[model samples]
Target: MSNTVFCKKFQKDMEALDRAPLPGAKGQEILQTVSKQAWQEWQLLQTMMINEKQLNLMLPESRKYVMEQMEKFLNNEPTDKVTGYVSPDDIVEL
Candidate 1:
């Protein structure tokens, strides 16, 4: 697919997420490999954005919003204690 089509699909996904009115936890699946395999995942993402030239397409506010959400999801501690056949409170939505 074209880059424009891909970006449009991504934008639609973000819009859908924004419309949802629930709190969410970070995506362990997305971060597990990408973050552990590379120490500077965030920095590398920025570098990749620069290389792809998509950074220019993103608004400053949008970039900042992404960073804020990403950091909160990745760095914050989970609040619930789950047992077998049960899930943590923080992961309830998922």
Candidate 2:
């Protein structure tokens, strides 16, 4: 069965994530409050950030930065977009 929650990010009631995405209280909070759609969106943004920043996930700082961004994103705060990235539609598909 699916669970529903008042998703703080989307500002409406929606289906919640099946489980915590991380290992602590914050993760539990997200599982209870964030929707699957919002989490997926964050994942895409996180990927963009990793690429734009050339973050080495093996390093602690990179992981910390990612977690910070995730928190902000889930809280409905604006996140930094990847700078100078051209949208795929702008690229000539040759």
Candidate 3:
């Protein structure tokens, strides 16, 4: 496979991940379609969601919710927003 892939999220050719971020078919699908940049952005969003929502990964519901959110995010569809979270770009330096 080439070092680049047509990223589904970004809708353009971008750098691909060195390997699947996870195991199983989902991981392979992401490896083929999701760009490195998109995956990194997803990770940040996932972390914030977990922290802000206090999602317990041990719970099946929590895991499922995250997976659903991941799919929506990768597809550039609407997903649940993290409340009270601020983007670094939005923060102005005094």
Candidate 4:
């Protein structure tokens, strides 16, 4: 199969899996898949940075920093989601 076709199918499968409310073993599978995709994207970015000489030349340093921060967020480090700017109670015991 062609790389483009394979990637598209994989992406669709991943999106479906991520959206499902799977718990325990099922949830772990989704997390693992997402993490693997994130790692793959990071590797792709490093490749583009090295190969696309003119691409980086067009973007500012601040833009590059923002992209780096975004990559960190995708890798699951602390972000707004975990920082707890606001909390909503989903369940209550009366």
Candidate 1 at 65: error in angstroms? 0.3
Better of 1 and 4 by lDDT: 4
Q: TM-scores for all candidates? A: 0.24, 0.83, 0.92, 0.26
**lDDT tens digits, residues 1-94, model 4?**
2111112214433322233223687445445454445545544554544354334535687457545644454545542232222234654567
List where candidate 1 sits over 4 angstroms from the true fold.
1-57, 77-94
lDDT of 2 by residue, 1-94 (tens): 7889889899999988888998899788888889999999899889999998999999999999999899889897877778867888889976
TM-score, candidate number 1? 0.24
What is each predicted model's overall lDDT from 0 to 1?
A: 0.35, 0.89, 0.96, 0.43
Alpha-carbon RMSD, each predicted model: 16.9, 2.9, 1.7, 14.4
Top-down TM-score ranking:
3, 2, 4, 1
TM-score for candidate 2, residues paired by index:
0.83
Candidate with best lDDT: 3
lDDT of 1 at 47: 51
Please list all clashing residue pairs in model 1, or write none if there are none. none
Rank ordering of all candidates by lDDT, starting from the highest: 3, 2, 4, 1
Question: Which structure is stronger by lDDT: 2 or 3?
Answer: 3
lDDT of 2 at 89: 82
Q: Candidate 4, which segments miss by more than 4 Å at Cα?
A: 1-13, 16-59, 79-94
- Compare candidates 3 and 4 on lDDT and give the better one: 3
